[model samples]
Target: MSFSTQVKNELCRAAMHRPCCIRAEAYGALLHATIFSHREIRLNTENAEIARRLQLLLRRAFSVDCAPRQAGSKIQLVLEHAEQLGHIFDALGYDLKNHVTYHINRNVLEEDCCIAAFLRGVFLMAGTVAGPDKKSHLELKTARHSLAGEETSLLLDLHLSPKMTRRGSTYVLYFKDGASIEDFLTSIGAPRAAMELMEAKVEKTLRNTINRQVNCETANMVKAADASARQVAAIQRVLRTHGEAFFPERLRETVRLRLAYPTDSLAELAARFDPPISKPGLSHRLKKITELSAAEEE
Candidate 1:
């Protein structure tokens, strides 16, 4: 299943409690549902779990029953009856006779618990969050711009900032940063998904770090091997161009060590000396041998 669906399913398992919070959640769902009006109300979902949750919300919040009208995978809880619509509308503080405003009534979300529940409803109806494997993003899309603006304010009140944009007739409120997405998910009753997102981000960062470290180490080894090859070639030139007698005893010993251990690192070759020398001392001797070899070539 998609990450968004997984979160919704987890949220559906939450026990129905507190009549006010349940009403707030239903209000959010209704406001963002595919079609919510005095004439008809419809909550649409492809997931059977969410469809069931919506049906339960309508019943619990308004004492109204709405069975799923299923056509393939798309499930809809539809209410065309005025009495049922009135039941939901009255619970959300709306009058049956008036036009419904495309905005949130902040008064209905007085408590923090109600605010969270309301956000939960909004997400179930119109929201989607990218999975851990994808870029960090979470969005709520509704038909009206004014409702999006109002929801933006509601999110900000909870210390979470979301930007607003429009696509065709839909107004979108979205969080782009991982931190914001995590917080939003946790706030809307999906802590497991939030933690998974954070874990994925951490694993990705760690893999990148290990890759860079390995590349750097490989580059350094190549550099050291190239330097060793050049040193060995210069030593060979000194031996071939000028005989062993051409060097003093100390330099001759260094030449013998180089010829014997062409692949040994400077530190390893230095330790093989009759009386071991420091790596810097061995490097200085090699440099002198190269100079002598160049002099012979000239």
Candidate 2:
């Protein structure tokens, strides 16, 4: 299943114990419903859990019944009669005389529990979170700009912030950073989803770090190989241009060891001595030989 679907299914497992929270959650679902107004309430979804949750919420929150009709994978609930719509509109503090404005009523979400529950309901209907294998993204989509802005304010009250943007006719509120997405998922009772997001981030970071280290080591090996090749060429030139007797007596042994192990690094060459010489000593001898080769050319 998709990450968003997994999260919603997990959230559906939350117990409906608190009456205020239940009503507030149902209230959030209504505001984001396909159509919720003075005349009718229409909810459409392919998720059987969501359809079932809304049915339960409508019944428990307002003592209203909304029958679900199934066609293929989609289930739709439509309530149009005045008697059924009146209970919902009145309980949510909406007047039957006015059309729905789609703005959140802050008074209904006064408690912290209710606020979390309400946001959870909102996500069940309109929210989506990308899988950890891809990118970190979470967004809530709504048709009303005012509702989006008002929801931002509500989130701010809980110390959570989201950016608002217009996508065609839809207004979207989203979180791009992982931390914010984690906070959002946890608040909506999906801690497992948040932990999965964190794990994905950690894995990506570790993989990148290992790649950089391997590249650094490979580059160092190439650099060392190039330097060794130049040293061997210089030593060969010095020997070809001048006889072994031309060397200083103290340096002849160093030259012999170097010629014997052309591929050895300075440390390995130094260690080959009967009484090991220092790496700097070996490097100095090699440098003198290269200088002498250049002098012979001049």
Measured against the true structure, the TM-scores of the candidates, in listed sequence, are 0.86, 0.83
* Residue 233 Cα positional deviation in candidate 2, in Å, after optimal superposition: 1.5
**Candidate 2 residue lDDT tens string, 158-193:** 789999989999999999999999988898789998
Q: What is the lDDT, from 0 to 100, of the residue 177 in candidate 2?
A: 92
Question: How does each model score on lDDT?
Answer: 0.87, 0.87
Candidate 1 C-alpha lDDT tens digits along 90-194: 877887798887778787899888888999999998889899999889999988878888888889888998988889988899988999999888887888888
TM-score for candidate 1, residues paired by index = 0.86
**Model 2 worst lDDT run, 10 consecutive residues:** 289-298
Model 1, C-alpha of 146: deviation from truth (Å)? 0.6
Report per-prediction Cα RMSD to one decimal: 3.1, 3.4
Q: Which is the leading candidate under TM-score? A: 1
